[model samples]
Target: MRQGINPSKTDNRIQLESTHRVILSVYIPNLEEEYFKHAEKVFKLCLESVLYTSHDKTRISIIINGCCKEVEQLIYSYKEDYPLIDQVFYTKENLGKINAIYSIVKSNLEPLVTISDSDVLFLKDWQDETYAVFENFPEAGMVSPVPSSKGYLYSTGSTLYYGLFKGKIRFRDVQDPEGMDNFQKSVGSKLYDPIHLQKYLVISNPKNREAVIGCGHFVGTFRKEVFEKSPTKVCEFRVQGGSEEAYLDDPNDRSGFLRLATLGNFAYHMGNTPAPWMWDKLADLKSFEKSNLQTYSIPSAKPLSKLAVLVGKFLWVNLFYRFRRQFFGFLGMKEKY
Candidate 1:
């Protein structure tokens, strides 16, 4: 089913004028067998989440960055397999996250742009929450589930570490024999739990604002107008050599959050990190506002990984993590999404 926009005569709010459309971009680097294998489950998870939750999955577009012949084949496979997606585009350019974002921002078709990373799992109603955040707080530039910076709430005294997925950020304090079980129990009924030990930091303390500044990995929302007027040059600060997408170059600076906070008070970064537990943790969080959201499970016919592939996955992820940290450290850089 297709829907058309009928803007009212007297409405003046910019966002309201541009409602009912959103664009999601999935940027891929080189096309490789490993890329598809490693990402397939989560990619399907993301696709399924939207299919089950959104009334308008047709609005979603997958933009494959830095395409090659192999990437083209991989994308074709996805298109043949998943029709809910409206279009698949492959770009040969090497624009990083920032430039890609600018491109999305420039597009007149999508009023809202969701930069969805390839390696994240989302709840079925993730977009519902995202849309609600923008609608409820018109000033909000971006909204996402809060990312955990440390382990679970059961971990040592309250603390946080930069996190991307649920299991990825193990809270040392919550590592007791049954700590995961305990933390899961405590975060009950909320949309998301804080990092293992830092639940207090995310949900309870009430940061007195709708949004906070930090790099939100899984997904980030942007008000198109923000990009229309965003500074072309990157902010000068502690971090170096990162995409201009970050408004704040200094990891320690909260200025970006403050800027975003002026727009709305409900933005939260979503998903777990520092590990690969995104699906599990997200599964635990309740969709407090999205009443119609539905969860679906596609039974894994079997573990897709072979022993050699499993070992290789372990090594590759480990090396990726270590190198990611060291590379950022060497450059004194951190992403602020």
Candidate 2:
């Protein structure tokens, strides 16, 4: 369903008139036998999350990077079916995540843009929280979710890491192992307990206004000005990682550019795992506010990573943590998500 827009009437005191609508760009690569085996399941989880949790005004744009006719048809079908999906663009060649995002973003840099991966599940009111942050703090360049998985890259910690300094930016900390059991049940996660260890979402503490400042991005939200100021090369060359998100929110200068992760996780990275946090969380999260939202789920989407799981287990055992850390781990060679 398409979201209704708020009236542009300005509050005289604050003089804030919000007309900005978020545009989400999802990159869909071909997932035949050569690609991910469970492509349909992964795609369904990603799409459903956006449909349910996003702001009503949000528009989704799919960037299909290859010339897969079936995939193109699939995206078109979605565009036609959903009123909220604004556009579907396909390229003849396969440009990976970095370049594909750069192509669209480089031109339409005004509206707030969400560059999302296809295998993600979003939580309740994810768009409301994100939009609130942007409206509240005009300086926030990027907003990410406090991830349960992909902890190394995007775990929203109370301690914000600067170049050398670590400042304690307080929020409700859910680092405890006890809460993990409940979260898994809420999302109907199928992965081992160990995977959930990294994939937990810290419900945003209402009192805190702090952000992680410069982050790792599975799903990254960026303000318009950040892109307008960046060079095309910086946007293009994220093959190894850092350059992609560097200039967006330089941690050392938080006053100028604020980088944030949603206080409570608004989304989950469905890396190979396919549990979306918004499916049924009102009861499990007593403190969580679920007003207009009900339950969301993709029962048809099952995990198709049995073979990948085996490979990951072998790698986890054969290589010591320290050995993996030394190599191109500075790059994402060691990363599981």
Candidate 3:
């Protein structure tokens, strides 16, 4: 039976005010193991850091990807406390990382979506710096707050081509060695040689605004339109492997957009274990000031023709890979690797 004179059909729907949305996928199965003993605390810090640093209008979506009931309850409590937490999805079974992320990203209405891991400590001004990169580089499709020393090697053919012809790309002194060192320590891997900490490839615009050439995948902001080119089918990998490259990285490049990062580190990967420095850094972080929210516009990426794509692939495979030293040297890389 239908109710008479229901106002639902005639009523206007509410509009979302946010321009950006942050997506986080958490998969903490249990806390019994030594590896996950401190996972809950670390996750709390990650959430707090984002809430503290993000703009008031920015929305946060948390995908509780088969986490324990305890973790779910904790997240629910956070949702109640923070108004910025826009949505929380819970799954009884574990969906792979990329699958879980795509489920939300596909339907996201915001123009900008930031896909972040469960344990990244977002520093202050991360949004500002990221937006600055997008404002300066109209071709940038993805921007990471944490810069990588060897990031220039990633799917950056378009950036390299533009740099060569425009003479805007060059090697610059690394801005934050301590921040890079912290990232290396967090991952427990030697990601860079000593010389890499001293200098890295950067691209600058006519306005003298500079950004790193490439970015890491742990955390990055993407234009929502780029994901429109991603495959509609679900990813096959359970966790890592080829999932990131297939779903996130390749689409941007194939669409002829540049992948870039901020000149300095504005986020830290806090891995599984909670280090003392993580807490110290969290304590040192300042709250986001409303006055600091600057208005800026991000230009859409110009789609490349089929001929341009074929030419880029040929150059990347033939010239760039075969004569790496000579090619990069021409773009102002001094050292011969």
Candidate 4:
């Protein structure tokens, strides 16, 4: 039987009411390299997906920094369609992306905050499933979705995973094409239609949070304590790419935190200029539904048997850790080594 999700799941450590709050903030800086029109299309799909999947009390923030007048107007236009967007910040100058994010971190408005990029698509169950991690593990410092590709440590998509028994578990991180076909067969939609794909975003039992050392903030969420308890000096200088993620790295126990990524892809990145990840493959999402489509399945959530987990971990690693190179290509690295 499919189990319903607990929208208000929270950690038992903190004695709060049954309800929990999460804020999602997106920072959009005008890219000198990207054509604003093309970027606008990607951003709209991002907002459109957000509007479809978010729940009540989940606040959305859009921080606009030195964007073109057209870009500025596009963001505001979202306000009418997506009421979840309660906060919008307009920065006078382009202090760069990291600085723009730093300003939101300073606000201290919500206990959990997600630093989402402008070019992303949040699939069904994305919001609640995201909250499930923080609710289940209060110790979790950060969480990101498995990307279509370029997830680095958290990548899923014909990628490799090492199991627990003597570097044993070796399985494809996910099976997208087969899963998508299964979903379409169930939904009666044609192949490659993005709308039909949402129904199959089933949640899996994710337990390998410790395997990765850091997270990619392209669509990552973090607890406010990671920053409020950090007690680190804030610098005026800017650090590029994965800079915000550096907070969780905390090399010398400076900040005690753990970084994690979701089991399957909950959200996807439509790479922008300078870094175009899966854009050629995903730019077609705009042809999807104008409203939320509800015919989806929530997979049964259960932990695997200890012996099963062991077999998955030990048996597979022994057989395939060497051949992982051929299956994963150069971009996909073996976790066991």
Q: Where does candidate 1 have its weakest 10-residue lDDT segment?
A: 252-261
Per-model lDDT: 0.39, 0.49, 0.84, 0.48
Error of 4 at 115 (Å): 0.9
Q: What is the lDDT of candidate 1?
A: 0.39
What is candidate 4's lDDT per residue for 1-337, written digit by digit as tens? 8598765665435442212233333334554554453676677667766765655546677777677777788778876666677667887666666666766676655556677777776776665566555554344456665422222333111112222222222233343444334323433546344422322222222453322223455667666655654425554445455555444333201223334455555666554422243343344444444454332222222223335434433433564444544543443433322
TM-score of 4: 0.56
- Candidate that would win on lDDT: 3
Better of 2 and 4 by TM-score: 2
Clashing pairs in 3: none
Encode model 3's per-residue lDDT on 176-279: one tens digit a residue: 98888888888899888887888888888777788898888899999987887898897888787878988998888777777899999999999899888888
lDDT of 2 by residue, 50-83 (tens): 7656544466777777635666787788788876
What lDDT tens digits, residue by residue, belong to model 1 across residues 30-70? 43566444444444455545544454322556666665565
Error of 3 at 213 (Å): 0.8
Off by over 4 Å in 1: 1-37, 40-42, 68-70, 77-84, 148-196, 200-217, 232-240, 244-337
Q: Please identify which of the two predictions, 1 or 2, would achieve the higher lDDT against the true structure.
A: 2
What is the C-alpha local distance difference test score of candidate 3? 0.84
lDDT of 2 at 320: 26
